[model samples]
Target chain A: MDRSCVSSRRAFLAALAVAPLSFLVQPDKAWAADGQPITKPIPSTGEPLPVVGMGTWISFNVGGDPVARDARTDVLRAFFAAGGGMIDSSPMYGTAEAVVGSCLARLDRPEGLFSATKVWTSSTAEGLEQIATSERLWGLQRLDLLQVHNLLNWQGHLQTLSAMKADGTVRTIGVTTSHGRRHAELAQILETQPIDFVQLTYNIADRDVEARLLPLAAERGIAVIANRPFQGGSLIDRVKRHPLPGWAREIDCTDWSQVLLKFIVSHPAVTCAIPATSRVDHMEQNMAAARGDMPDAALRRRMAADVAAL
Target chain B: MDLLSYSLVDLIPFSRETYFRLFERYNIGVWPAPIIGLAMGLTALFTARRADGWVLRAPFLLTAACWIWVGWVFQIHWYAPLSWPGIYFGMGFVLQGVLMAVVLGWGPILGSPEATDRNHGPGLWILLFALALQPLLGLLSGRPWYGLEVFGSAPDPTALATLGLLLMIRHPLRWLLSIIPLAWCLISGATLWVLSVPTWPVMPLAVVLYLGVIVWPWVSGRSQLE
Candidate 1:
């Protein structure tokens, strides 16, 4: 049995058993590799949010690992460097809000941060606590936008959010649902409730939002933040193996990511398209969607048909 | 179970990158753990077919060690802080380790490989492949070499080695030993599948292999013949 080998290995293992954790070291800040800014106003407040913003869904839920935290810092650097704002997160995303805070704390430039997060709980009290916790986690004195996540206990939470807005704890109040869930209810709420914004999933493949929700938001003068613009990265993977269409250049889309992103933001009702990404290169690609020649109503139809065909 | 309330909001709160980074960080922090793990896996492979000897104890001992390492190092220390469900997973791995210990330490299970259903050739092959080729899965998936998941330090290979070891053991008790590893394969596999990982199918394949090894000898009357 190589007792000496076992003993030495055991010693090494014990040493490692107590070793300090390796958090992501801060990397050299990279410049945003894209051009220009595209701004759209919140219909209620008339406050402008760049059409290309950041979402912290799966991409930003990196827990407390410093290495992952530092990597996201670089992504944020690329985002803000490209004139991006209106970064969004949720309490349901585990430590994502905290990770976003950690990244923000390390960022050299955070003045343009339009911090947005959700109150994701079942009660008014819990929602209040969660909202306060989210603010603490994000290191913000006041949240820029607060939405009821997925409409879970939405009516109860909306009252709290409405109060928060009136009390100046949050600048904007809204409701959110994704994967096309609860659109009827969302549209009804937008009609009846005093919401400033509506966050929901809207992309090339998932177009149910186009018929009703988009039109309703426009009609009600509610700002729209489009999420899952890449359809949870699945749509990007679907078109990645195929070559970009020659017409993609007409919309200033360099890749399938931008092509998908530009399609969503091109909608006149969409105040912003928050495409979540961890890679700085992908961030640059997403931010570039804001600058290029946007697709017109006619070309947007062609973009949808092309991706649908693939 | 309410179909009306069902939605696609993920129960697991981390992304695929975060999950992979957990393995990467675990493997990196342990440094030479994989080197020692390979030796332990090879030790299990060489000693698995032995009947009524000290050598027969190697596989279970190594399996228990791997399970405990995954329990404490990977699940508890690494994953638990990330999500609340990881605490349950950590406890599950520790429970598996304790169960293996009870079976190996006190019961008439140690060094008692029965001849009834043992297939030395395939058993050795499965054990070696889990220890050797399984670690390369990270590299094949375009991750760096440091992302290699090894038997003594990772969940998938440890569960796989447990199955391979069970293949050389006797009936009823062998069935008992297969429960945890098989259950983990199904669970971990589903999680990976949801995360869109390529190796997701491998767990279900392992479950099929384990079921075949356990049931084939009985159905064919090979156990009666022995």
Candidate 2:
């Protein structure tokens, strides 16, 4: 090989080596107006986690496309840049977990990244393999949180997750379900099983969880991660069609996305709300929810009713 | 996990953009496909009224070509990598195509006297819709007109037009022929539903309409099956 090409290659490797170290030394610049993110604690461990996180379902499933990967890199960068953490992915989301890993690996500072992915298959052996595969994909030696996706074989996976947690391989273990599904069973597992987190669908429009799951999680001291925070986009899309209600400024929400997101995260039981977005602008807007004082109970109800009216 | 109520779009191996990009790429790479699809659609339309034994086979031949094209190009080539289920969908499309060819070309099902056109009413309109309306929908939905998922170059149009042709044929194997396409309508519809695309309800409505057409003859005491 030519000397110039060899030197360039060495420079690239050197930059890669220095990137993580640079990020580690630098203080997190993702501060909000108060110079700190509004955070909620992990109910079980008392570990403080930023309430706004990123979800990679359809958003990060871009496969082997360089342009798409570059775009997602910006999205991840924005997520971290805005004091985001607890990125949740699953093997079921096609290439999402791998894409997230790739993005984080290339990033300057993914230190705040609280890696969470799921074990999605049927058999315990397959679930174990999937969990290991997720760790490898994300390049994490110890996963912060791992869950049974959609509660598929939760009985088996829960035992496996607990075992992994005991071994210190996984820092936290939990179960996830969305779209108002399997709540009864999920509740049963949460009550019967000793898990750290329970992820479910909770948005302004979909408050079915508020009655049972959220209360149950709070009562049980299990952390709650809210998915489908905007009713999978329709809610935000609807809210965006109209001007933001003047009352939105009362809680310091600049846009409708923040208003909707803030409503979910403000719930006493919600540990975090992971809204999936493919664009950097959306990530910026989403993470902005972490800033600003959240709506109080009456304001939250008003926000819900106002959005519902739309 | 709200598994039961979840959007089918998640089951799709690729993103909505990637799925549509298949059309964008196919339209650009294979310019001849749309032209061929037009010609084939015209041929089916012209042959729709024919009762002659050999001439009646044209629509079935067109349907088979459409099924095969959509199977290979849309499903196998573009969609398979996105998810494992995509491979099954591709295989299903291919099998449906082969089945159509076998039935029309050979014995047991749509053979000899069975391959006859009766009411071309719904079929003609449906074929025309497949050829014309589908692309219009695609264009209205923000996909460029040039990148329209034309019949034979696309799965939705191919499946829609196939249902139209099968409706006219009045064969015992008609429903059998309709199975995969009907299923595709539901699957694609659900995919659209989850993606929050405006056209999500269109496929399910089409399926219901086609089912109504298929069952009309029996319900009216025309008794083709009897």
Candidate 3:
């Protein structure tokens, strides 16, 4: 079997979801890239975040000059204009938080920003110190949500965050695990802790989370933020060859990326799916995922069955 | 999920002054290890003779997280006051400078302890010397080298030499140093495309450069270096 073929299939299936917005956003920067309303209310706060969030995780972490800084700022402006609310970053992402803060400083801060980030390191004290660093770098008076990055120092950080949330230093606290490495442990943390959010690897190709993590999060009332939404560009590699299917028009995905994002968001339990894109064009394409009528349950199941076939 | 429009192709240059702005800040020190790491891994994939092999393949992906962590911690060394462990002798001066760069640009040589000596060209030695001397200067000054950092700059000859090697590197050495810029440009280009609105005319230049890296050595009639 050609595994890359499956990648292509997954890519095509993923693209099926975003076909329509290309009609609007593809031609020029004038079309808004973001502006979709929330698909799920925060179970803890019941506040609806625009399903589209800016992921500065790796995209904005470059530096050495103003070009680096200004480009990031423009993307941030587009994100705000397009109705994006969540901005997820981490100290692990290098200069992202600082750059993101600098960009936001230039913009009129968007309303309902669920500013989220993670503390990633092994030591509890170190993690605490890093979280402080993250806040200072991002220029946050208060973080809307904070998570133990990738379960690093999760238990120790949980205690620290729980206390901070209690004292109002942070608005909410959660734990995260990506790369699909720490699922068993992450599952335990979600089962045990009162975390408001849980970040993990989930995409059309990665449905392992669906088996247990998704069901658990919905049951526990914990929100899920899917990272590696494009599987770090692997998903795109898969779809480059396959054109959108003739049947794909029913769902409206012009490009392969929108289709992938829509499929993930179509899930009943997903709170939000955070995908990082450096290109303003990609950002507009991704934000369009929020506006349309997502596939119903039956379609989602069909979408899944077809991709898994390969 | 939010829909973002645009890819690397559509860029609008902010201004000419924007070009000069590159030197105004002390930023080369800041590296996005994830993207850099991804580039490193992908390059390794392109270089590898084999396409499918799990024996060592997954480790390449896993290294992304490790390199990123090291990148994060390295920031503390380069940006913070050099102290115990460092600040203790207070260590963390120019000499510890090696640690600062080590955490960030350690590259393909990472975890392969055997390759360390080979990766060091005539240039790396100068960097090592500067790394050792900077801290001594800091100690003599009674301040952390990073604390009293003038330009947040390093004047290491070795690093300069290595960089010089990069301007025209080929063969095994080219293979090694090329990863640095390859990772740097992609990460920076992606950042620019995603974050800022710039008239970036560099992608085509980048593609050309990438092609040059692959074709130049062969076409130079120096493929014999292989």
Instruction: Write the number of the candidate with greater lDDT, choosing between 1 and 3.
Output: 1
Write out the backbone clash pairs for model 1: A23-A67, A24-A66, A24-A67
lDDT of 3 by residue, B141-193 (tens): 24333222111132121222223223322223344434443443444345345
Model 1 CA deviation exceeding 4 Å by range: A1-36, A62-69, A121-129, A240-256, B1-19, B31-62, B80-85, B107-124, B142-144, B171-177, B191-200, B224-226
Worst 10 residues of 1 chain B by lDDT: B1-10
lDDT of 2 at A57: 78
Order the candidates by DockQ, highest first: 2, 1, 3
Residue pairs with colliding backbones in model 2 are A177-B1, A178-B2, A181-B2, B13-B82
Ranking by lDDT: 2, 1, 3
Candidate 3 ranges beyond 4 A from true positions = A1-36, A308-310, B1-226
Q: What global local distance difference test value does model 2 have?
A: 0.78
Clash counts for all predictions: 3, 4, 65
Per-residue alpha-carbon lDDT of model 2 for A1-310, expressed as tens digits? 0011123234334434543222121111212344345566676676657789989877887766667889999999888887787899988887788788889989953777888999988788899888888889898888999999888888899899999999999999999987888889998987889998999999999999988888788778788899999877878887899999988887677888898888998787787899999888888888888776667677788988888898
Which CAPRI tier for candidate 1? incorrect
